[model samples]
Target: MSVPAVETAPLLNTPLYDLHLRLGARMVPFAGYAMPVQYPAGLLKEHLHTRAAAGLFDVSHMGQVALRAADVTEAARALEALVPADILGLKPGRQRYGLLTDARGGILDDLMVANLGDRLVLVVNAANKAADLAHLRAGLPDSVAVEELPRALLALQGPGAEAALARLAPEVAAMRFMDARVFDILGAACLVTRSGYTGEDGFEISTPEDAAAPIAEALLADPAVLPIGLGARDSLRLEAGLCLHGSDIDTTTSPVEAGLGWAISPARRRGGARPGGFPGAERILAEMEAGPARRRVGLLPEGRVPVRAGAALFAEGGETAIGHVTSGGFGPSLGAPVAMGYLPAGLAASGTRVFAEVRGQRLAAAVAPLPFVPAGFKRG
Candidate 1:
């Protein structure tokens, strides 16, 4: 995902900023907000702890918008005009992931759409929220209203997330992946989704800004939950083979090239009932059928040396470049260095050997299946 640069201007703080500081977090500027990069426990420990238990993340930096029309059908149809996803098919109380694409098929941002019974709630990247809102207003029918929610979002993620959250809200225990519901926790009303970026069984909670800190503290009070920061958050998502908007995908990168075709529902594809009306449909659909020139793939470096983003990749023994790493680092869960980048389609298959040029030296690497660590989502 495209992380906004740390600008020279003043930075904003989330509702949990004081709580993070109190917990001994190291704060840094991210996407115009002063965010916690890590706490006293460090990224490595935070990563492992989340996998074994639960991790509480302050994601108030994300944008939340409520899209309402005459009804759910109208709202979904209006949204479908901007994205390739089959929003109309999204059942109430469930969510689906999608990308906002420009006319040229390049990604503007990726987002999650949750059907909230009366209205559709969209959670978009903080950096692109403003643009995304404008895009929605311009493309959607006037009957559909786009209102940004002044809410704070938090992510409670990991294998123990369900249990930990259950302690406060038992109803959350029955929520499956992508399920959404409104419940009261610590006297605060929240829209909680059984979804997260960690590729784990988790929930993303949206609550009023005023109540965010209290709810977060309540969750952290559980033994299974610990505060995590952006550092571990990045490493965790990278290990799950999840793309970061600005780094792995951007306005120059199409969904097909990013290996996110799964986000395009069958109903939006050619020959389906609602085929190809969204932006860049022609080019995107063509690429989907003919295949993209370059495809994102997982890279496993041969040794201990970590290949970071922007590292050049070359064909075995050939100096000419084929692709570049978009996200890379040591995966705490895998206990090895893992990276993901784009490569020519033919060179993207698992077991395909490539070389990464690091520090003027070429190191052997292999194209491996994505999610170096298997995803633990509770799909059932």
Candidate 2:
């Protein structure tokens, strides 16, 4: 089922909105835009198809921003002040995952930062792009320019993505994970990155807005490429244990507590040259030294029933609620129910038995390792 729109405000449409309709997509509202929830083939087939072959996703609604300082190094330093990652040390033609943190030590947003040859580019969530833009503008020095890019983003994912994209830009076949470069496709200058949200080997293509439809058309012309929608995207990311902002991690969750400690650069930690500059660095560094009070972990429900978000977690026989599910659904890949939630550090171990309160009944569940499905990134 697709998430419906209830907002009174008029919703926006992406560059591929018309193409989606033409392809028989079941349009639904997501992040204030009319997006496809699934195509004629439906969500289940789309999910399994992506795991086996290839799936094309329209993600143009996401925000694209470019940062420019006097020089590339200056731009990296300017961005380093805002994110936990070591942007100053980032090399050209590479990208890294970063977090925008608030003074309270909570994550404001999760984003991808790429070191373009002359500037740096950031890809932020659609729901938080406005706020993220405002934050960047206000925080960065006046000399630095924070400009939004009007580009369309598309994701081609699965084990076959490499071959599919290589047909158009042969150079992409040699790129490894997190590599970013520019290529000419259909007379358009495109920024191609070897990265994706799905736990599959894939590539994210950022191209001109006007060329989106035809580019999508060209890709769909291939038999292996199927149009996937938000429904399958959600289930795929869940099985991959990827956190969705506003659902799994939010203003109240810290990166350490959210099982994202690795995103923090070592140079930003205590006893380093550039230590303690970012917002909430004090608390974040402290949490690194002494573990957080609670931790995010995976949950496996014993039965076939789907456990959804907001279900409260409890001790097997205890009455008081300890935590609640942040993201949950039936894992199409596993043929079982999977979820993720926060719990006291003591109870966060794998195989720890717990119960979730669902409609007045306690269902048995156990803490499991994250990524119910293993990640298939081409790290080489």
Candidate 3:
């Protein structure tokens, strides 16, 4: 479905607001809309539930756009020129996550692009939608049509997500991570993808805006699927070692520095030797080989005091500032405080002792391996 030309508020309201409220969701402002931060079940319960079963999330505010041309080959080249990912090698029905670079090669936004049977579908951060669309429209050839899907996106994430989705569409069971298809889900024609920001085995369903509520209701009817608010979503993704846009990464950062070098394909890296594709290509390519000055690293706080974003990470004596926390919270699954931040490369090794200055006191912390919780993504 084509998106309506309606002007949306910075705080856009999702079709599930009423249902979220009915379920006693704690509403908060996010991405220009009032959204549930947590449901009555609280963040702890919701976090655990999603890790153990299925957690339904309303992520419709995310921008869903399609770029189409007469042929997939032309479309792929145009996209590959803008993103570092191996878009040209993407098979039909498979998706790849990548970053949009500024002329200088700094990351503008992290996005997911899929080779739909006929076109390329892009899912981007809601906060960067307008700019992202403008960037694509400007860079893509005139022949390509950039259409934003008028749909409400839902995510059924966790270990039990497959079982919950199969109750409605058994075909979902066969999809591997990052594979998407237009399928009938709960009687509604929707796009279902086996992917999510959370590193769990899950599916993101994009239903026609109006049919969203009904499909969401149907999914929740199953005892295994519970409403998950943004709070839990943030925590879950953090535990999964996923970066949050605008925080962990932004225009000032490059994918290599953000620990997203895997997103760049060998073709792009080799292309860098010639140095002429997108913004920041020169610097980004150089960093790919020499390494970033500062890198995003995971930190495990020693005590229960949850270190919040913006907390300062200090060197041994807690005098020299080494890094700043970007995303931090209580990892319900890990049963401890976990955080991700950018630190000088010299201080980013595992087991390196660091201190986080929380309010007034210094809390002991250590450089830790990411995905504090194991990722359950379907590899095959």
List clash counts for every candidate, in order. 6, 0, 12
Q: How close is candidate 1 to the true structure, as a TM-score?
A: 0.97
- Which pairs of residues clash in candidate 1, taking residues 3 or more apart in a chain or in different chains? 1-243, 1-244, 1-245, 1-246, 2-245, 2-246
Candidate 3, which segments miss by more than 4 Å at Cα?
1-10, 271-276
Output the better candidate (2/3) by TM-score.
Answer: 2
Clashing pairs in 2: none
Name the runs in model 1 displaced over 4 angstroms: 1-7
Candidate 3: residue 92 Cα off by (Å) = 0.4
lDDT of each: 0.94, 0.93, 0.88
Better candidate number, 1 or 2, judged by lDDT = 1
Task: Write the residue-wise lDDT of candidate 2 on 1-380 in tens digits.
Answer: 99997769788999999999999999988999999999999899999999999999999989999999889898889887888899988889999999999898999999999999799999999999999999999999988899999999999999989888888889999899999999998889999999999899999999999988888899998899999999999999999999999999998999999999999999889987688799889888899999999999999999998889999999877889999999999899899999999999999999999999888889999999999999999998
Query: How do these models rank on lDDT, best leading?
Result: 1, 2, 3
Instruction: Supply candidate 3's per-residue lDDT for 211.
Output: 88
> Model 3 misses residue 124 by how many Å?
0.4
Model 2 global lDDT (CA atoms, 0 to 1): 0.93
The weakest ten consecutive residues by lDDT in model 1 span 5-14
Return the number of clashes found in candidate 3: 12
